[model samples]
Target: DRGPVPVEEGQEVDVTVDSVGRRGDGIARFNNFVIFVPGTNAGDKVKVRITSVRNNFATGEVVKGE
Candidate 1:
């Protein structure tokens, strides 16, 4: 079951790169939360460090290499 989460802003998380966006960011998911990672592409395994959190989406940076 889905429980309440207490993830803070700017929190780092690990996720798999799923696909790329038109703006060139990478799409990843962590704990069922979707995040957009900059400087990354599709099909790349990466670790994303959260940069911003919104109501429905999140933004992050790649902690690992491309």
Candidate 2:
């Protein structure tokens, strides 16, 4: 059985971009759950706001970065 996702829409979280997706979105993970953050790059540490959450992955917007 599947559990509830680790994040919710409108939530903010900090993560390091692990890799870039095919469409250029940055990939990060929270509790091993994938979060796709646009406008970020690999090795980027950023704070992102969760925009959409799906069954297997979530999408977020970069709120700030380091």
> Relative to the unseen true structure, what is the C-alpha lDDT of residue 24 in candidate 1, on a scale of 0 to 100?
85
Error of 1 at 48 (Å): 1.4
**Per-residue lDDT for 1-66 in model 1, tens only?**
345443457677767888988898888877776788888877787767778877666898777764
**Compared with the true structure, what per-residue lDDT tens digits does model 2 show for residues 1-66?**
368889999999999999999999999999999999988989999999999999999999989887
Error of 1 at 39 (Å): 1.1
Model 1 Cα displacement at 52 (Å)?
A: 0.4
List per-prediction Cα lDDT, in the order shown: 0.75, 0.94
TM-score of each: 0.77, 0.94
Q: Which stretches of candidate 1 lie over 4 Å from their true place?
A: 1-6
